[model samples]
Target: MSATRTFLMELHCEEIPARFLTPLWENFVHLLEDKLEAWFPTGDSANYRKNAIDNSTGLYSPRKLAWRLVGLPAVQPDQTETQVGPPQRMCVGEDGKPTIQGLKFAEKWGMDFSAVRFEQPAGKKEPCAVVTLTKQGRPTVDLLAEALPGLIAGLHVPKAMRWGNSEFEFVRPIRNILCLFGDQVVPITVDGVTATNTTWGHRLYHREHPAPVVIATPGVYESALETAGVAVSVEARRTRIAQQLETLAAEVKGRVVADAELLDTLAEIVEFPKIVRGDFPADFLELPKEVLVTSLREHQKSFCIEGPDGALLPCFLTAANRTDDPAGFVKAGNEWVLKARLYDARFFFAEDRKHPLSDRLEKLMALTFQRELGSYHDKTGRVVALVKHFASRMSDDTDHIDRALEAARMAKCDLRTLMVGEFPELQGIMGGEYLRHEGAHEEVWMAVKEHYRPVGADDAIPGTPLGCLLSLCDKLDTVAGCFAVGLIPSGSKDPLALRRAGQGIVRILWERGWAFPPADLIAAALRVVGAKATKPTAETNEALMDFFRDRVAYQLELAGYAGSVRRSALAAGWEDLVDLKARCEALSAFAEDTRFASLAQSAKRIGNILKDEAPSTDFDDSLLAQPVEKVLAACLMKLELAPDQASLLHALANLAGPLEAFFNAVMVKCEDPALRAARLSLLHRLRQAFLRVADFSLWQ
Candidate 1:
């Protein structure tokens, strides 16, 4: 038995973009693990696996990407290699003696002619000549040295750059490559840089100490970097920044406005994080809270501070890469940059407010939403029509319908505002703010602002009824237009984000319990889109509905429904998303009953028997001659007539016994054609009842 070892590799490069660091490191780890696992299989037992790699640790900063694999075997186990050669017929002579081909094949594998055997490989029509040999495994260090260079080069990033005279490209120029196995260097090389035991520290913070940090072993890498003033671990830097931000915010009697995404980005942007608290003129707080927060985060990578009541406090915190700001230079620089950004924001706001959101409607005609789908102005018209169509169905009040229509007309107007032009994330938010400032109706403004709700899976749905209706109209119009223009999402390509739009519609309908049929909504939206829609009406309607069905299943899955349960519910019909969700929930709970498995199997049996046979559900009760069939019919009648027991689960439960008995005694395929058709119809009714809840046949 061989002892385990630790392997470490670090690639230090020019500053990587903050967004690319984490994903790049993750890709590197995935590639390394996949290759290593193949080279060293865990085998049958946990003890055998103990010799394979254990924990894998990946860390990244703007300037470095590092990975550590622990508990790796010093050498891979010897493997059995099988080499397949030419067909046995080609290798054999007429007399069954060794032919030239046979001899050459044996020699190629360093085996005698006697060692060659004939065996058919999978998917082959003829048996082929094969030779098996035991190959000795090489030392882990040598294997790594040969494999790491290519592995590093294979990493995929959003963008790559070439430097110096070399044709090699990476996210940035490679400055250093440090590779160590246990206490020894593995001798890997990537690009033009060769691996060594030495790596640089924080480029600016360690300038005074100015000597390369020499790591003697994989175990000392983290501590050694810490001594050199570099926080190599991303989590460590994130924690330190978070704690410092809280301490700084506490000093001002405010809390940091939490933004997990910005926090993650800032964590990767710096190596050794030093918090700098800065303030801008209080007048900046008068800007909409979203504008101030977005400017602070987007422009400066800073966190805004909020008072106890959640009002913006005109203060922000930034994470600077240094040990200390003894002269307060970092703080002053951050404050100056923030002030400049705020001044620009204020100017944009003042300019945008000069004309109300309504006045900007004409400007949208110039902004193309999609080349074929027309302009923002065109989309607004479609959305307004959609809102009118949906709102009428959703509400009978004239005021509610009018307010929703107004919101749809003004939702995209902010795309022309200078503030929104400067900050695209504030499009919907700016529209609402401008409307409110103009003294528009509160419902209309709120609807415009919240129409883009539930932007991500975890985001909140629109809070008000009018907002929900308007959101559905807006999202439905976008999905319908894009899908009509042949922009449907396939595989990983969804340039129009039709998937997200579809999901937003699903989440709003399911969460808000709206009962509008998705097909009707698509039809209405297509009608509003008019000639811009090129796809055939029926074909476009089905594609959009199928897209929505998938979104519904996805949302239900996210809500913790099982795959079979979701499939079953969706299999029945997803025309009404809210009803589909309710069915899923009921089926999920009912699946736990002790009789569920047998009943499900029986339901599946009923489907199999009735497949391709659609008998009229209106069967003659007099035709149910068998006592067992009579019992089943009676149970179904009691269920249908008993209005008090109308719940789907209860109906399913009551049929379980009668269905089991009916299948046991009734012969669905009988000698008598009329009686057979009657029995089939009876089974069909039972299947229909099952489908009312779910297509139980889809259950595993």
Candidate 2:
């Protein structure tokens, strides 16, 4: 028996990018756990490994990544090694003595001939000569010393660089390595840095305490860092920053504009957080709310504060990695920098308002959408045409159709603006603001602004009918044009974000309950793209439809639909996404009924029996010989064609009893070919009815 101990390891380096910290820490922890589990496997060793992983904590900041594991075994469990040799016939002679081949086999395994025994391995019928040996467990400290160097060197980050004269590549230069097993240091070296039990504190806050802090044990690692003005735990730092932001915002009778992403980035970039509130000129509020927030968040990494009325308060909060700022130097510097950015934004806004949004349309001729797809000017023409095609199908109001067309024409004009040149994230948003400032129609301006909604998985779709119409046209044109030019997305190589664009299209259609078939939409988009399409129309149409089907399946899975239900519904028909969703929900709800399994199995059996036969519903009822066959035929005829999906599912479930009885009592393949054909046609009719709701043959 061996006692359990705690293990800790830390890598101190130059500041890593804020986005790379979380992923690097996660991979590092996962790799360590996998290695430890593989090295220690046995009765008590399993429990110790489980405890270590369950109690582990990953510490990550821009400057450090560390892990602390508790209850790890001090030594690996003993293992057994087995070697198989020549077959029994080769190893034994007629008198049951060792043959010359057997002696060499035993010598190869470093065992005496007497130690070899005849045994049959599992799953093998013949006996073979085998030898078994026991290996003693090694100390955990020794294993760590041998594994740590390679593990540290193999950590992956998006972009890595080499520093100084060393050939080692890392996200940042390694300054120190700290490792400990219980109270003893683990002697390991990574690149040129050697492991120790000492770590430094916050670079700025702990300048007065320049000496390194010695960690006596894994149990006191976090507390030791805390005493030296470093908060080692990421969650603790985030909570502290959040509380400081709220407290400061409350002091000025305002609330901090909540941005979870910014909070996370700030947490990763700081060791200790101190919040400072700074003010800009109230005239900056004349700019749109989005511009103010974007400038503060993107340019300065600061948080905006809003008044109780939900309007901008002209104040912002910035988090500094320090204990305090008694003279307000940090606050002054942040305020000055933010004011300069706001001044530039105001200038751009004034200049952009000089012309109507429609006047910028000609500027798009210089911007290429894609080399094969012509310029943004050409794309706008396609979009306007697509909007007309889709709008006519969806609505009859001429005013609505004209508004969508107008929005399509001016959507890409903002890309040429100075404000958008500085902040590319505000492309669609700035266009809408300029339109509104020039007294454009409310519907037109809003439609332009929201055309790029649902940019990612968790984002919202366009809020208005016209907005959704415009968004669909824009996204569809891009996807269809790219597919036309043979730029389809494959594997992970979607440089144009075709997958995201496709998903946005599906989401907008499904969420809005629009009943357009995917093929029809693809055809319309291709027609708008006209002669630019090089691929055959039928081929491109098929590939685009399959792509849309995949997006629909992905979205359904995210919404918690089962694979069987999705496949069954999709196989029946996926022309209308709204109808597909309804069928899926109906099938899912019906799955809870007591008769579901029998009905599904019956449908599967019918499909299998009629696999290659194409039988029509016009079967001769007079040829039905058995009573069971007649009863099934009558039940099929009596099935009420229900208008709603749930009623249809219930109607399908009613055939289970008759189907079971028919299969049990009747044999379809008879001596008379005509009789067999009639029975097959009857079964085909039943399968067709089931196909209306779902292809139950695909049911698990």
Candidate 3:
């Protein structure tokens, strides 16, 4: 008989950061589903069938995320799959009908022609026969036993530890686990929590009187929990927090400053979200709004409220641990933290303004960006030089470029200032403010702030010419300096953020419509700082060049080029990144056309014969006595006259007939040495015809 089952699980922690709950919940749900699928194919399946059965599962996270799976079939249906045989022609005698071969096929499967079916084999239109094999499936109980424990065990956090004699590691110490098959416990345990039929409600809200929840069916388990006063859906928690914040903000004639990620993180941490309003002294509002807000968000984890005109308000809303007495307790706690954070920010900002940004440039000499790399000031020199070269080469506003260069020269100057030293994220922002106050041009001030444009993937690219130039130069220095210092990124290790820097360069150049090649930029920047670089071995330097080539290739590939096209372009060489991109794009354009398949096949065949190795220059054309060879040579000669794409493609088309005729008439690897060399040379010439496109063999 088919029946349903459910699993309810929860862990009581000692104040787990709300931020970690949602991700952990997602991880657990995914792991459980994957395990269940691997075992039964569908959670609804049971031990009663032999075919894959389908199932449904639900996951919810409020303070705690829970998954309920229901409507699972008891077993898989009977297996009835077919094993195909060779074509009927192979099974029939000269009579063109069933022979000994056909008899053997039928006898082997213990079936007659009635159970057998005939169809065309895949990739061929010729008819063939298949024997169906039918077998019953096993019970689902065995599948669940094998899958569940290990799947549950794999649900762990960023860091884990060993507990008790068991080896399972979870984010927190698990207290109880509930696994049910219909109304019966599945009989499982993790850490020390044995599977039960009950789970707890809201921690503090139900503190006075806890309720015992019954885990009957999948639906019953969740409904039972809801009756006990706990919300286990993360979306619900987030909505509550946002709604409460809006309501509280409206009361004070202001709007809640919406920050999704912050709200999301807060929602995951606590079960019962309570928006508590807090206020600071009006005097602190005198500081710049950015400083005030950063302190609130970064340090206090509070949302700063703003008036209708976008002016800073004294009030901030924070998510509290408990709903009771939140107004009194939360206000005091949050206000205290904000006051301390604002004081530090104000002190650093005031102290930093005492000196002009230009005067602090020398101080970067002592700041170490990395252990192997030299001081920050040394980096500034590299950046400044690169920016000047970029300015000269690219068509940008000269005044803006010069201002940008000046700004780049002093961009890292603020790193030495007490403000930037204390708050690293405020580097460019602080530099802009200080530069403007120091009597620098407005362009220079703007460029200083905009140089680090697009700090993340979704962030904006530089718009103004000076902004673009500085962004390009700054990223180039980061890539070059890291490579120079032997700090190249590898699989999963990009501490230097070389990947992000490369991405930034691609975005800036593409957005600004600059036709400059990134490979040329890398080479030029390398030349300027090559002497300062810790010289790597020839092999390592080659690897670094290959790394840059790969970065450019990946960006191009993501822009929608075929893998074959990308490989062909990259295989040609990595002399110029922009040219490589053009090559890939051009090849990709051809690859999409229906005519391309034939061209690709022809190129692939030539590539297969010649490989990448070029034929010996010593070609004895006299040995090519066949008319086909003579015709092919004539075609090659014509192709060499005008080697553009259309001409090359035309030449290849002309050789198609001659090349096919030659392959059919003459042996390529001849016994005679002179003849073989000529044949090889002919094939090599054919392969070279498409070399302007790509080496198709490299793609496969």
Maximum-TM-score candidate: 2
State the lDDT of candidate 3 residue by residue for 384-502, as single tens digits: 88888877776467875677678788777877877666667777877877787778888787788778887877778865678778888888877876787677888999987888887
In order, what is each prediction's RMSD in angstroms? 3.4, 2.0, 9.1
Q: Flag regions of model 3 displaced more than 4 Å.
A: 1-4, 18-38, 41-170, 221-229, 235-260, 274-290, 303-317, 320-340, 395-401, 513-519, 527-532, 535-537, 560-592, 609-700
Supply the TM-score for candidate 1. 0.92
On lDDT, the candidate that comes out on top is 2
Error of 2 at 71 (Å): 3.2
Cα lDDT computed for each candidate against the true fold: 0.85, 0.88, 0.69
Question: Could you tell me the TM-score of candidate 3?
Answer: 0.71
Worst 10 residues of 1 by lDDT: 44-53
Q: How well is each residue in 307-383 modelled by candidate 1, as lDDT tens digits?
A: 99999897899988988899999989989888998999999999988877898899899999999988999999998
lDDT of 2 by residue, 97-138 (tens): 999999999999888999999899886679999999888889
RMSD of 2: 2.0
TM-score for each prediction? 0.92, 0.96, 0.71
Per-model clash counts, in order, read 0, 0, 23
